[model samples]
Target: MSNVGQHLLSGGLSGFASTICLQPLDLLKTRLQQGDGSSGPRFASPTFTCVTIASTSARNLTVFRTARDIVAIQGPRGLWRGTNATLVRNVPGIALYMTALTHARSVMAVSPYFKAVQKYPSGDSRTRQGSVLPTLTMQGNLLSGATTRVAVGFILNPFSVLKARFESSIYAYESLSGGFMSIVRAGPSELFRGFLASSLRDAPYAGLFVVFYEGLKIETYWTSHTTSAGIHSFSAASAGALATIFTHPFDVIKTKVQVRSEARYHGLYKTIRTIMTQRGIAGFFDGVSLRLSRKVFSSAIGWAVYEGMLMLMASA
Candidate 1:
């Protein structure tokens, strides 16, 4: 198969694995971000701490309680409520993300700046005498990550909208088809309702993720401290954690904009203003910890598996 095809397969497999493992966390994060401020007793009483429905809750649910609530309400499978939509979104979303990243790097490599750098060969054998390519610059990594994330994110937004609704308390669709039909009934505009917020969140998050991950790898390689697999996973997790923290407010806004059953937010600016007025400074940071944990775990698993598959395929 072609290189792009391999990237697609590897990315799809890795993303699938990551999504399955982290779906519960993802659900919790979404629920927390969607929380409004009202709290009530859970019917099943998932845990010792307070737990409530997404729309009803003002405060974020604790991660432990969130997991328990899912089990209590819908059984263990409840945690994976949006699995189908998530898989559909992530599998191809990640494939396209990875492919775009790679192609972006290649495309960047041929730029005038890189071409100028290439004019002067490195002294290192791995980059010169041996069969190893040079690393991307920080700028290149950031640009590629942002560009790909925005492109694929926009394309796959409908799935994102569907997934959010599926996991949310807003809609109780029996099946994926039901959810799709409901969204269709809502109108085509609903699918792209949060496109601006999503792009704003995704573009910065993706850019920072690549920059930090690649930067970490560069440092690790320079230190010669571990194997490629170890470094890759570590870097991915580290990057994810940092990026999630920095861009968490955008995530909150994106979720709010995407999943509102009613038209609460007229636009991105108005949404931000409303959140600030209602929830204050803390509103934008709802579920930040949960988001960070989920992002770290998912990114680590996805990047590790993807690189491992590439290594295996190269060996084969």
Candidate 2:
């Protein structure tokens, strides 16, 4: 009905689609990051110049082998180990993020600075036709993205803790509810064990992603003199990839904290210290490539589908 409503619907559908298509990769990334620097799924040759934060064995690991290992250990359904928890986390998380983005842009559009600038030729034009103003300055984009993601991350951190544990060897949850109850028994605070690290990762990643994606879209729209869904997808993928590279270490620490039953890596500082002491700088970047792949693919597909659905909904 409304643009914000449309954004919420589009975000949910897009997140659902991406989660289903890429759950296996997400599983692998979590598992890889969860492993101590002795063993985990391998992605390439042992000599491929990857930082082995997983194992000292140093054996070659491939995606196929990793999938097989999962299958062998947990059956074919094992690949989707934490799918329910993931859905529980992402659907609301994405919807809220998009809604926040829309609101943030709307707020920015009416800012004194924006009103002053909009008198020029480069001003927002969507309002001319009663459409929502979508343009935002780079600063607005980064701040809004970071704020939305961090806000949503706090709401969804409980699901995140469950999902990470389900995906890791730390816990073998029989079902989503069972896992949730277990955590509740552990204590409500346990559900937010890694909230700080999660915030650190999510805020920066989301901020950078929006900065890169929107910046690229504006640049390409001007430079190429054309716009298309394909271009949007490419920009989303590029943004996701870049963001993952920068925030991946935080991801590793977050996973470590979430899945651990003990307080070994208790706080963010302790986690970083332990990682550095045990595995060095490379430890923080364990599964960087896998994470990049998942983020790029999922974000591209999700954003493309979201934008396309928004257009369709508006036209209808």
Candidate 3:
């Protein structure tokens, strides 16, 4: 396969894997973020540190309690409350990823590094080889992922507001009427919602995601030369786990900011400060276990399926 193709394969796989495996934990997190139960940020965010969820009867893992809580209040369908939003988020994220990666790979093909190697005194022998090209190409991939993620975020901010609101509160789920209008009426500055945070979070995480995925495949190629889907799965899981940690603070702020009508949190900085000073450092990582665990499963399965789908598409 072509190197560009390989990058795409990895990207698709990562996308699918992240979704399926991480979704359950993600469900719980959304419920927590929306304040579906009890008081405190635990309702708004669901910290692992919450003693209430622990002290409650009929619970083992927070996953189980999260499920019970949802079913009791909202019924079985509630389990998937924000699922469409999640899927919606992924589609654009992937579309942007594909476009960016393709462009990046193409630009770097004839870049200076490859040109230097081509004109080098030691070797014209490898003139048309892909090995030297990928080194230069990966840099392009990083740039492309970052740029496209930013561009994609603009198209997607309204949807993000939708997701946050829907997941955070039943009121949002009850009415999908506003659509983009909600965002438009949100005022010029607020339209982007958590965009800057999302952009910053997505770019580097996506870049490293590519790097780690490619590196895993290379590492496997060195030993057994297997093409297990696990490499893509694991890479995505790892990347998602890491991204969650860096981005959770912003994630919290976004939800609060998007849903607030009175501007209790003001801007991103103020929102963060409010959360920290009022709730402490642990508040920032609310629902971390659920998020991390979800990343492992969702990234693994979603990415594996998505990559397989792409290969199927390409061959067809």
Candidate 4:
């Protein structure tokens, strides 16, 4: 296959594998972030924290309880409720993002302004051990990852909306097409709901992920004097954890804007205010554990599979 074709196939495979394995976590994260959809004054009062504490003591939606509830209500298959929408959104999304990143990095590698800093006399541009793509400066990595990710996120925002709503109990979207048509009828506003939050989350997350992943790989290679898929996976997972934590608030806001129809969630600023007022600081971290778990595993699997495939294809 051509290089671009190889990247497309590798990315699609990686996305599919990760999505299938971790769909349950994604669903759980959405459900937790969606909350009970009650934005009453009682939830915003100073005593609200005590009420929350008491409520949780009574019937908290812990991860295990959420999983159990889904299974009880819809069976085991319910855990993967949004798999179809996720696959449709992610397969092409990953493929395009990977391809764009590769092309961007390749272009940047050749540019005098963004070229990697040389450590040896030969001034080679090859990546360090365990990396297949051309090495560029950290700035290049950040720029390429952030720009490509946000652009792709924009293109797929509608599918993202569908996926979030599908995963939530709040929306009973019987089919992917039906859900999409509903959004279309709601106009561009609905189609692009949560896009700002998504961009905010994705840009930093993708950029920092690449920066951290590459830095870790280099450090690991230096320490261990070796490189392998295991090293790549470890690096990717570590990077994913760090980036997920830093960008999780936007994730919470994005989920709420997409999944809920209340007036409080109709706009980005309103959603942020609502979450802060009703749920306080802890609210932004809702489902963070689930998202963190999902991101770590997904990054590990997706990056390992993608890079490994490219290395194999290059050799072949």
What is the RMSD of candidate 1?
A: 5.3
TM-scores, all candidates, are: 0.87, 0.85, 0.71, 0.90
C-alpha lDDT values of all predictions? 0.76, 0.75, 0.56, 0.83
Model 4 misses residue 187 by how many Å? Answer: 1.0
| Best model per TM-score | 4
lDDT at residue 59 of model 2 (Cα atoms): 21
| Sort order, lDDT high to low | 4, 1, 2, 3
Candidate 4 lDDT over residue span 110-194, tens digit each: 9987788652223333333456777778898889889999999999999999899888776666788987998888789989989
Q: What's the CA error at residue 2 for candidate 1, in Å?
A: 1.0
Candidate 2 residue 123 Cα shift, in angstroms, is 14
- Model 2 spans > 4 angstroms off: 38-64, 114-133, 225-227
| Span of ten consecutive residues with least summed lDDT in model 4 | 45-54
Which is the leading candidate under lDDT?
4
> For residues 193-284, could you state the per-residue lDDT of candidate 1 as single tens digits?
78898888899999999889877766665665565677778888999998888888888888887765434465798788878887899999
To one decimal, what is the Cα RMSD in angstroms of model 4 from the true structure?
Answer: 5.7
- Pairs that collide, model 2: 37-54, 38-54, 38-55, 39-54, 39-55, 42-61
- lDDT tens string, model 2, 255-282? 8888653355788888888788778887
- Residue 229's lDDT within candidate 1 is 72
